[model samples]
Target: MKALIIAATAAASLVSTAALAQQAAPQNPGPVIPGVCTYYNARLLAQSSAGQAVETRMQQLAQEVQGELQPYATAIQTEATALQSGGASIPADQLNQRRQALQQRAQEAQQLEATRENELRYTLGTQRQKITEAVSPILTALYQEKGCGLLLDRESVFMMNPAMDLTDVAIQRLNAALPTLTFNRMPVPAQ
Candidate 1:
């Protein structure tokens, strides 16, 4: 009966010790550090005023190309209409030949369009790189000044309080620092 009482006391002591240990565990209940979290989108920065200027220039170039190609496009349409109207009067072989010629012309037009697209992409990519390069030093300065411990992309964040957003500040700083940045002009080959 004494051994049973001692065993019961020991079990109670162990349980009490465990409960005490759990309660003694340390916890952090302090407020979070300000400026420790930051986020921005480099793409958005690139699309600012400087980026818009680059796009405007590209659009102008496209318009010029379109003007030059307008006559050819009209000629192609006219020829197609003529072929359609003269259908059976044209020999089968001749008709096939004309069709092939029209197909070739269409392919050429498509090729020109593809080339222009590639050129525009290259131009835009180069401009974007320039903008990124210019903005990086400013971003580094901002990070240092703001004491940002973690910087993330705006797009990657699911939810962020308005206070957490530094994009507007960055944009304002960038715009002030670089009001108008000229992109590297793409060289056109002389005919």
Candidate 2:
């Protein structure tokens, strides 16, 4: 009976100690330093004035190039089909001429596609640079205002607090800072 009483008292003391330790444990007060990190969705930033304008022009250029290339595509296919079916009875001179023509046509189509791709790529590059230049200062100001130690693209994060997102606010500031971008010229790369 005495042993049982001692065991029960020891168990009660252990329970009280555990309860005290739990009460003394620190709470999770979110981040060590609030607003130390922030995230923004880049795609969401595309709704800005400069970004919207760039996107519209990019779409228009794509449609225009596709329209221009359609006829050439058809012509090349027709020429290829004709060459395949025309037997050796077709005069050697005529055959050579047709072959040369097909070669030239195919080259023209490739060159056109390559040129259009380069042009669009250059335009998009310039548009991005212009917007970045405009948005940088404004974004820095925002980061300071929000007490952000680090800012990152939301896509890079596994999960984040909604309060740490700065995309909408950044877009508004960027639009006001730069409403439009001159995009056609390729900027010279630094050596």
Clash count for each candidate, listed in order shown: 0, 0
Segments of candidate 2 deviating more than 4 angstroms: 1-33, 182-191
Local distance difference test scores for all models:
0.63, 0.68
What is the Cα-based TM-score of model 2?
Answer: 0.71
> By TM-score, who's the top model here?
2
TM-score of each: 0.68, 0.71
For every candidate, C-alpha RMSD to the true structure in Å: 22.4, 20.7
Candidate 2 clashing pairs, residues 3+ apart or interchain = none
Predicted candidate 2 versus true structure: per-residue lDDT over 1-191, tens digit per residue: 22323533554564465446547645642443466555443443356888778767766666676788889999999988888898476898999999998999999998887766666666666777777888788778889998987787755654445567677788887878888765453434445
Q: Pick the candidate with the highest lDDT.
A: 2
